[model samples]
Target: MTHLTLSDYDISAERGFLCRYDAPDVELHGKMAAVRNVAMALPKTLVTGRLRDLMLRDLPNNVEADDIADLTDEQARMAMVHYSFLIQAYVWGEADAPALLPRALAVPMHALAERLGQQPLLPYSGYVLDNWGLFDADRPIDLDNIFMIQPFLGGQDEAWFVLVHVAIEARAGKVLAAIPTILNAIATGDTDTVRVELEGMATHWAAINALFDRMPERCDPHTYFTRVRPYIHGWKDNPALPGGLIYEGVEAFGGKPQAFRGQTGSQSSIVPTMDALMQVGHADDPLKAYLDQLHIYRPPGHRKFIDDVRTQSSLRHFVEGAGDRDLTLAYNAIIQAVADFRSRHLQYAASYIQKQGKTSAGNDPDVGTGGTPFMKYLKKHRDETKARLIDA
Candidate 1:
């Protein structure tokens, strides 16, 4: 069987998705400048009005199969990158009222992905796989190495929050690389190899937790809640967007509707990797279920990579060993912190989702408005891991 590399999917560009970050001549650049001017000079209502109009009028709404054929290779690539940032800003810039993304932006984005043979959204796996070499544990975290562009119109608070996830995703990439070795050890009953791999896994979790700890220093709570948090809102229940974001020409798998519930894009990435590491495989494990459903959001190769990791057994044996106390504690702390992170996101959702006249209640078995099941699983996993350490 052939394995996939990031280059196979045309995602190996050094700049990640921000290909237009330096492109000042693109039509999208002019529109972005206009939006920023309005944001700085106008009232909140006026800013939103201007942005909505710009989105509907300025951006390319109707994308067909032959659209990219008309452009040079570089032009097509820049168009995709430019539109990626535009979609993020249009959907997430407004705090209380995120505009429903029209076909102009949405269709072209989907078409761009199809043209490139990639997924519509920048899946977390792509970030990890494409940038695998940059994720050295010994190196200092560099904000510039992040996969997504710094929101051109967003503030420092927004930039910091995005960097934090970029750092965490780097750490996740390291963990993902080691998983096959750990699983190989488990399959062969190599306890010593398993112990070593588990230790490394714990270290990766610590690094992720450290990034979370640094969030306050980079972005204060006030700025985060007010500026950055609102951008991550999903379309679960807002009256304005009844069916959430609809990708034209994208059909739901298994005959379900092709609407996306509101979510922070990277939120689905790290926690699921940790959950797989600890083997928290309860029947109601929300992370596991969510990950299973989330494959559709990823490219085919990325989906295969995630599935390979999930199918492995949990590393519970290492916790039962006599010298694994620190590893156990580190593992428990990581799970707890992830659960806390999810809880905080829920609080943010509560404040914004319902205020827009959208139902915060989610009916998806994989995910809901409140992440109650995932939280419960994390708590149970943490307690059980601690108990095993004590008993050992």
Candidate 2:
């Protein structure tokens, strides 16, 4: 019934089931192109509001008051592009889903974004659309060159794995993309657009959380850690990875330093995505308990994240010819980072529960990026997500 094939999640297609986005069996390549076109067209649909005028006209000129206003102009522009692309992915995934031997799980995802008004975050296919193009005043950015080599666990029991990829893609395209929109639209009174965006984003968030599958068997953690982790960060040092996506660079002044993993909906609280991964291997009591437990050394609630980033920072340096001593330091730094993260998370969790009620899911997951600060932001405004779900 669904359009997924074993190939969608698994690299080997051990069950011979993955759906091809651009294969001979289907006009996926063409559809892919069409999807990009449609997603790219969405921002143009936004008519300028007085807020828009203020963002464009007032923010840049007046540097004293609401300094963030100048910053948000660019943020809103990029946010617009993100929503448009996710919607495009939704349509493409829909058309391509049933036609492929297996459905592309991302179809329903793209559909969710279409309805909600968010866009894809993994934006792997986003390169095709040139989100960077929004800022490009000179040349065109090439995105089609990027091909996906999605690796997942496949064989007889790979159903969950395949479904999981669907969730990842959906989150990337749907949920994560809407965080800024949901958070920012309140300022602009464009709650209608964001209401839709939040619902669609929630669709992806719910899907990503639903996946209880494991990564492909016999694969390497080093592969995930070394090869994959940095990819999520867009090899922050790599020239190919755009600086805009890299959160720490000169390009980002008003924002905190962050690294996004995949186009998967990491746009929101990337920390939640990290939480999802840390907990992914476990379940129920194990995950719940693990999530509840706090480490003494690491920050209040961010032990895992700090550790990962410090390790990643070391790994990045090692790639550039750092010594083993540096690598050793990296490992130690990761531990310290974890300790620090844990400390902050405690403060964050308490604050979040205070505002959103104790049982609230804290649904939006931030990926490798920092968690607590954004969690606070999302917790305060989480009602917007619910408000979006209201049927018009």
Every model's TM-score: 0.63, 0.22
Name model 1 segments beyond 4 Å from true: 1-48, 61-63, 68-81, 91-101, 113-148, 245-258, 265-267, 283-292, 317-390
Q: Write the per-residue lDDT of candidate 1 for residues 1-392, one digit (tens) a residue.
A: 13324333322223222121223233333433343333333223324545666555544444554665565544454555455545545665443344345556666667666665555543333222222223333554455544333243455766676666656655555555556676776666666676676567667666666666666566665555544444333454434345555554444322222444333443344455555666654454654465455556554544455555566555665555435565555545545555555554444334333223322223222333322234445445445433433332
Best by lDDT: 1
Candidate 2: misplaced stretches above 4 Å? Answer: 1-122, 126-163, 167-209, 212-227, 235-264, 267-373, 378-383, 387-392
Candidate 2 Cα deviation (angstroms), residue 74: 32
Lowest lDDT sum, 10 consecutive residues, model 2, at 94-103
C-alpha lDDT (0 to 100) for residue 342 of candidate 1: 53
Clashes per candidate, residues 3 or more apart or on different chains:
7, 52
Q: Local distance difference test, per candidate?
A: 0.48, 0.28
